[model samples]
Target chain A: MTDENIANHLKSLKKYTPARIGVGRTGTRPLTKDFLSFRTDHAAAVDAVYGEVSSKLIEELDLFSVETCYETKDHYLKRPDKGRILSEEAKTIIKEKCTPNPQVQIVVSDGLSASAIDENILDVYPALLDSLSMYGLNIGTPFFVKGGRVACMDDIGEILAPEAFILLIGERPGLVCAHSLSAYMCYQPKKGMKESDRMVISNIHRSGTPAIEAAAHMGTLISKMLDQKKSGVGLVI
Target chain B: MYKKTTLLGITYEFHSLKEIMAKANEEKSGDELAGISAENMKERMAARAVLAETTLSDIRSYPVVAPEKDDVSKLIEENVNEEIYGVIKNWTVADLREYILNDEHLSKELLQIGTGLTSEMIAAVTKIMSNLDLIQAASKITVITHCQTKIGQKGVLASRAQPNHPSDHLAGIRASLFEALSYGIGDAVIGINPVIDTTDNIYALLNETKEVIDRFDIPTQNCVLSHISSQMRAIEKGAPADMIFQSLAGTQTGNESFGISISMLEEATSLIFEKGTAEGQNRWYFETGQGSELSADAHFDVDQLTLESRCYGLAKHFNPFIVNTVVGFIGPEYLYDSKQVIRAGLEDHFMGKIHGLPMGVDVCYTNHMSADQNDMDNLSTLLSTAGVNFVIGVPMADDCMLNYQSLSFHDIATLRNVLGVSAAPEFADWLKKQGLTISSGQLTKQAGDPSFFL
Candidate 1:
């Protein structure tokens, strides 16, 4: 198809989503600009997977730190089970530093993409806290988790005993958006909880759902979860 | 570590694992020639002594293989014997799917013989399906043929090539190509997976691969996989990429887990169809499997096999040249067992062929998966009978880079020997003229011979 004709059809579909549809081609290949952009996006994703969350970010957030059993990225990739729990020292540290029985506990982790944390944690973290405080919600001591997966929240929940908890972690880096983050929320979440019992708000990136907007949405959702005493499948609105 | 040694002035750079194996294979091939005498041994030993300065220790890909067959009693879950008997005697895969389609109260666990089915299930189910149905399953896959030009002569077509290297350095790529030429080698295409996903990397690698094909007179088309869009860029820059490869899942959500969706696939397919070198031009090599739906949290109460069929539904629209299922790569968390894995492979083959898409089986498994070569052998024969178009031709039933075990050259030959089939028509004449009895010949020698590296 001609580039103009392809773009004409794609122009309509492109507005509906950030998907890679309607990407016009040159003869039998992607346009030079699209190809270079794909290269750029892929580079970001690789960087995200390999990059580490900065200590400055943690210090700025004033969040204490703990780590999952995953001591390396290789271990994290192959062993999902190992990535879901706190290390022995980490468990002790979290137990010592964290608040007990708070109405809501917020946690952050560089789950699969440290670049995700680098890009949006600044806006999302503070915005979430402000939104929760505005609702007169009492929050627990927020902490950062190193080498954490989404399920690590359950371990934190078990240690701290919160009514509702949210784990702001990085989603797996992809060529689409390397900095996409997800907020996994659950009510009274404990270890051995099924995945279906957790609720997630994903695609929290600049091009997707903006960080500031998602934080406002997350606070409202957490408030509703506390009101209903439920999350995931049982929680309504 | 790249050894700073020059072979005819080409700096040999490769991972130690790849280097050691390549040099060792070169040594073993020289040692295993025709006859041996004391003088010949002494001379060879003297040469080996000189060669030891640079050559690393031999590393066989399949150093040891487990004994065939696991005890079914220990593998199958308890309390499913009654359902097993019903699947074994009354309903075939199609019948069970009919029940699943009608929303009957059947166990969602009931799947392919390898993943969830027991040895007993394999025994009972194989009797019901027609040999032709098993055979016709692959016919749709191989019937669409592409001609290859070997310096203006017809080359091997409708075959899979051994394509994987750990570091994917030039030395590793060369070693893999040599391994691909060994006995029982021809399958479909030679596709290398570049460690670095870039236009320059893929463009250089595939262009070098074409030189290897011309130099060695290899018969198949070539593909260096980075990503479809990136490959398109390489092609636009004038690289010789035979086709594009991608892993497709059923739903929009499920496909996104692989960093792509159906719409993205549509854009790629439309682009590829418009550009190709072949007169018979069937491009876009797709791979799909069950369990991705569940793994991606998109199954939505749909059975894995049904979700897999929907993946084929997506591939069928583009008229894919080859669509394979990496059935066992997903591991036990999804398929659970050898029975489930095997049954899923067959189910996918059936569905792909039914969708009028060419289907191949990556009759493969990972170490973490609850399957062995014995189980893969069973599936290979069943798929061969059911007409699976081709399989991934890895060295010694293993891919060093992909980290998965697949049908070795020996397994392919053994299957073809029993089934009375050979390579596609393009290579059949060559196989005969060379007097290359692939199925009848022995690809596996006794222990101590250096294994080929790819």
Candidate 2:
């Protein structure tokens, strides 16, 4: 047969025809169904983990002062930029409720993916603080950054000017669970500083990374960053 | 609960213009009589002396002191001498020169001012001059760059031809092209050469380009064209090009080398010849597998490995056909970085492989280099040497597509068009044909039995 005739015949075939290829929709009825399922599963998982870690923190570490507590969706898809800046109410609450100039400030916020912070932050935060305390590093008032991007840490650093600022935020949501939080630490972060300049410990979640371990590592990284007066790729240790 | 914390900070102030000018006038008086333009020089010298004196007075008045970190101080710093007086004397003259040369409008208000010119007028003149310069420069130049592979005894030796890492190179090239085009470079063509073997590197290069687009600003509708070889095409298709082409051709000459079922080859040739012609300036994208051999001898055996080899051979043949009969040839060799592979395959005239092929490929390669320091320097040198015109690397890709990072398809298409490719319209039409179905947070392709190949 001629090339034209053959091409025509091949075009008639089902395989060659363009078709809807549903990517990232595996083992589910539809995308909406799969997404909902993922969200619910992640929320429950995060809640369970948080309950265990927070209880332990309260009982063993005597960590009772709660400045602010809030919840957001797992994917945080509805409010993507929410984590970047503190709300007016949140700012006011922080000013009134928490001590103004503690050696260090500790905050918890749902960042890129709320589920990440929900799943990882509790265990990570306490461990980080414990490590810092051991090093004789006094933390100032700590606050959570909800829906925070990496640059938000710079903003916080500007406001707090804590010898060093530690931000535990969720990494970008991936196919894996959304609750994978990352710890972004910087020494006096300011505007115009590139993201690479901020030190980060990503993948802090249950599946690939464990929270407590990541916290310990993050604490070490922060201490080194402070000691060297550098963060991100510039931090040697 | 959230609270507000007011962080204290300090700001610094600089000397005033009057003080600086006074100091300058004093300094210039000592050097007087050194110039031939006595009158004009005296005025200028006095101005300088006054500027210096003003600076001294301002410094004496303000004094330099380190501010306490937490202290509340005015954040605004005024450098009257540097910004106001210096700009008035230096920038105003520059603006007037530019205005006179370019014949651009000079504001009457600026002339009336005691100072040489107002800041607003200087800014306007500077903007106009810069834009004109950029336009003039862009119209006169076109750049060609490529990335390819060299086949080695062990494997493939990949290198990108640009000073920056492949991505940085792509970004820099795109930025330059966009700047040139925006400044009125008409029909600028950026040729790209890709080194195909492992998709990882190619995808990385594309991703780098994508990163450039994402991180920087570039004007739209700039021309960019890409020429990729068949082997590279096969890699993109995730299959061996020979088998795919054979299957598409409906060639039943099973397991025959160069046999290609004469009828199937003829039919394919006729179809391409009819659709792709020199008069119409039709653009054709060729696909093939990687190899350094080709033979018309029908007695050869055909297997997956051989099929892959033949794809490269097919590329050599198709390249000439496209270049001679069409607007351009998008050869993969230009993109491949492995010098040995390109040398063995194309540079050596497909040594021990295909012979008697037509010439004038008019192709550029794809480069994929990391943002790492070493790679950037190597890429810059390579691009400088190759004089590459265009490139095609991903700005982003879904996890399913080789690289987990995704790129903006719109930017890529626009870049290609800017590089002078007739294929851009067709590619854009194909994308639009996919329609508005969203899947996995991305547009889904439509299910249609459209007979385009026919």
Candidate 3:
């Protein structure tokens, strides 16, 4: 193959995958542009993990805030179990503020990549609300949990005791999409719930699973869970 | 039996051998997270001091997890050459370290000595080793393995061209594989980690990668890394697989969490021998990491390093074609930063080599970890200099599928050139024929162009 032919073929192949192929190299090393671009994407991903969900967005979503037992980003990364339960004050506040035994309880968390919440909540939250309304589900008071993990839904679930629950949480950032979010849904979530009892729709972002589509899909899943009185592996989709 | 030591005028006393082993480890976040690491630097040094004085027999007498309780411990205990163990039964951990680093000992003598050692003994010596000590000791040993082609010979640096796609698109896998082949990579194996772990998915991936190898007439093997059961099903149904792959854990409970067991592995081995394409005696590929047992809640109160070494003991029993520690993928709770990751990578390589396995390293890091491509570059180069068997090569270090960074195809090619090494002999010859590389394994003008295959 000639040089130009190879370049065109490489360009054409790039559409088939997200892998960083076809970027020309310089003597068994990446060219400076491609190298720097990769580093930049990695930097963005790292920053996304360290970034925080802004308060303005939380207020805009009309969600009150609570915190997990983990107080700092470092602690959150080091002790995942700490992120799985509510703080003492958070537990008290949640009990005081939340509506108990609702049909659907929606929660948000900056699980691993806070930027996932920062970038995605606006589109996904509103779409989810509309979709739930379409399903005619009784929505409970929504709130946010800081420095939280996916299992923190169980803590909120214990307090609210919703018939069905959905926690829109941040996924661990990847170079391809740092702002991707995941929606984990469970039926009658409680402490000591088996992980297999929860279902998830992951990679919600502009590029992957579009926010609105994922929200709509999640809404449909919630209805199925309610219908079957189950979620996760038990639910027949 | 003595578990107390004073270093720099600070006294430290560990409650048990497990505590001593965990504290002696160079700062790892996982031990800290488990609430088992030494309380301070002086205490850590004190633990190392006590550990170095501890004898091999002492460690053997007190298995971290007893043989009756865990099959992994039983298997490791069962594999020990009784005659060889008797010879070294009284050697202190410090004596073992000096013996390994001594200039007189070469690959043959060291590997023979390794038969006497248990995984715990190996982990003990590793805890006291410096970075350079780990590198030098490992460099003296060579572990050659063969599947379709020979790998891990002296002056030969192999690379596994991991052409993984997020959705397991065959065309996309081929595209990245072409890029790897163009750089004279994939001498190790054209392995793909399929997104979907079903039999059909693994079967298609295995067939597709095999087709690429056959079409190109490349001296390489093809594998699809799904669950062992999925691979077994695919191979049983006549997928053209070169080897079976599984992620290993160090304990019975940990292995169960991965849904694998000794009997299952034995069954998979038999099936591969009957139905696999590889003609060599070695045909199983196993990957492990530092904190998988802990992640599965099955560490048995053992430190990650000790548990990691035990995985090698189990791997050695299978006589695998290749074994690699997927270093840095377990996240910050285990490794924390580049320093800990680098330390674990070196320690894993040395320990596996000492246990007589064909060891490689997936010199990689996730985004959440406090590491970057520079760390991978450093570790990969360090492992290469230590004569590591192979390093995983993704396209531009970006695995969009597995969602981590590793040594890129370009990086592997550079390591080979900079270290004055070549690919496996058979694959190097093929690279020369394809005009991708010259006789010396240096990239030709035809290199870096995946369209060469097109």
Candidate 4:
């Protein structure tokens, strides 16, 4: 085949998949352009992990600030157990500021990618509020926990003891989408709950599941969890 | 068993055999996260020193997780060759390492002696081995298993075409698979990790890959890496599946976390043997990694390296057709960076090979880890030189579904060309027929064009 025919053939194949294909090679290795493009994508993902959620966004969302036991970015990355518990100061602050035992308690955190919250929360948060109100649910005071893990909801859950809990957190960044967010919900969340008891709606981003769509969907899931009095694998969606 | 050792005028003591084993391991963030890693460099060396003097009998008697509490330990214990064990039970762990590295011993003798050792013994020796020691010992053994075609033959490097689509789009999977075949990949298997785990989705993927195989008459098998239960249900409904796949863990509790058990595996094996399309005896595919046990909170105070070795022990019971360690996919906690991932890859490959399994390495990393494509390139080249049975091939080294990077189809083609290795013999013959590869195992100019199949 001629080079032109191969190019068209590659284009046709590339149309069907999102994978990096048909990038012409130089000998056995990838060409410089394709190589650098991949490197750039990787750099964005790494930056997302290291970046911090802006305090301005926290104030704009009308949320109080708290922290997990994670002391630094490196500590949070290495010691997941530490990230699962609230700091003593955070516990006291949460107790003073947040409502106790509401129908639904919502929390936000930077689980892995701060950019996920930076890019997505403005769209997801308002839609979630509107959806929860439409569902006629009593929403509790929402707060932000810096450097928190998915299970950190348990620590917050124990202090507040809500019937249902939702933790809007950043997902581990991938090359295709660095600013992806996830919503983890549990019914009667508490300390020492099984992972199977938590449900997640992941890949919420512009190109994947749109932030507003995922936010709207979470309200429905929370309603279902309340109706069934359970969550995770046992709850029918 | 010895529990205290003095090294460089510093004395160290361990509380138990498990602690000794944990501290002897190379530095891993997962072990440290569990609060079990050695405190300093001297302590690590001291633990290795104590471990080297421990005998095979000592390791066997003090199983990491006792046989009564864990079915994995029970299975491993029951499978030991008693006669061979009697012959080598008195050998020290250091003796075992030297025996493996000895030039006089060939693959057959090494494999025979491996039957006498348990997983703990394997982990013990692995901790004491250097990176080169791991590679040199693994390169000496060749484990060949067969399904629709053979894999792991000497001088034959294979690739598993992982044509995974983010949405399980049939056309997208086929397109990536075509790209892989153009580069003479997928001699091991055409496997896809479906986004949906329902039986219907697995059935459709199985049929799609089967159609591709039949249309081209490719000497390869097809698999959808769904849960084994889903695959079993698909096969029961008459899907054309060549092998069943599952992710294994070291402890029974860990397997439970994956929703699998030995009995369930046995049932799946029987169903495949009774209904599946594979023409060979070896028909199970398993993927394992370090830190899975700990991730499930089921490591039982054992180290990740030892838990990973026990996964091989479990895979050995089934005689899997292909077994690979997704070495770096677990993330930075288990293997912190390129350095740790590289060490774990070599260690996993060596341990799996010595257990007489068709071992492969999915030389890969996730975005959260401090690694890049260069690390993958280095590890893949090293593994190919180590005579790995196969490596995973994704389009352009990026997996949209799994959200990680692995070796690409071009990378496999380059490895085969550079190392003077060919694909499994039958697939190589088929590639020659398609004019994608020449007799010299170099890719032709017509290669890397999916339109060639069209």
lDDT of each: 0.61, 0.33, 0.92, 0.92
lDDT (tens digit, per residue) of candidate 2 on B1-454 = 1111121332212233322122222111111211211134344344333322232223223321111310101111121223334444433333443333442322232222212222222212222233233222222222111111011111111111111122324433443223222211211112223333244444444444334333432111111112222323323543211111231110122223333443444454444334321222122233232221111212112111222322323333232211111101111111123232222122211110111121111122211101121222233223212222222222111111121121112222232233332222222233334341222212232211122212
> Candidate 4 chain B, which ten residues in sequence have the lowest lDDT sum?
B1-10
**Candidate with best TM-score:** 3
lDDT of 1 at B309: 54
TM per candidate comes to: 0.49, 0.32, 0.98, 0.96
Better structure of 2 and 3 per lDDT: 3
* DockQ-best of 1 and 4: 4
Worst lDDT run of 10 residues, candidate 3 chain B, spans: B1-10
Model 3: runs farther than 4 Å from truth? none
**lDDT (tens digit, per residue) of candidate 4 on B234-303:** 9999999999999999999999999999999999999999998999999999999999999999998899
Q: Write the per-residue lDDT of candidate 1 for residues A1-237, one digit (tens) a residue.
A: 454654454454333333232333232234567556644655666578668999998998898888899887755654566778999999898778877999999999998789889999998998898889888999998888888888888888888889999899998765556788999999998998988889999989888798878988889999999899988887889
Model 3 — interface RMS deviation? 0.9
Instruction: Give the backbone clash total of model 2.
Output: 144
lDDT of 2 at B141: 26
Interface RMSD, in order shown: 20.2, 19.1, 0.9, 1.3
lDDT of 1: 0.61
Best-matching candidate per DockQ: 3
**Candidate 3: lDDT of A206?**
91
Error of 1 at B305 (Å): 1.4
Residue B352's C-alpha lDDT in candidate 3?
97
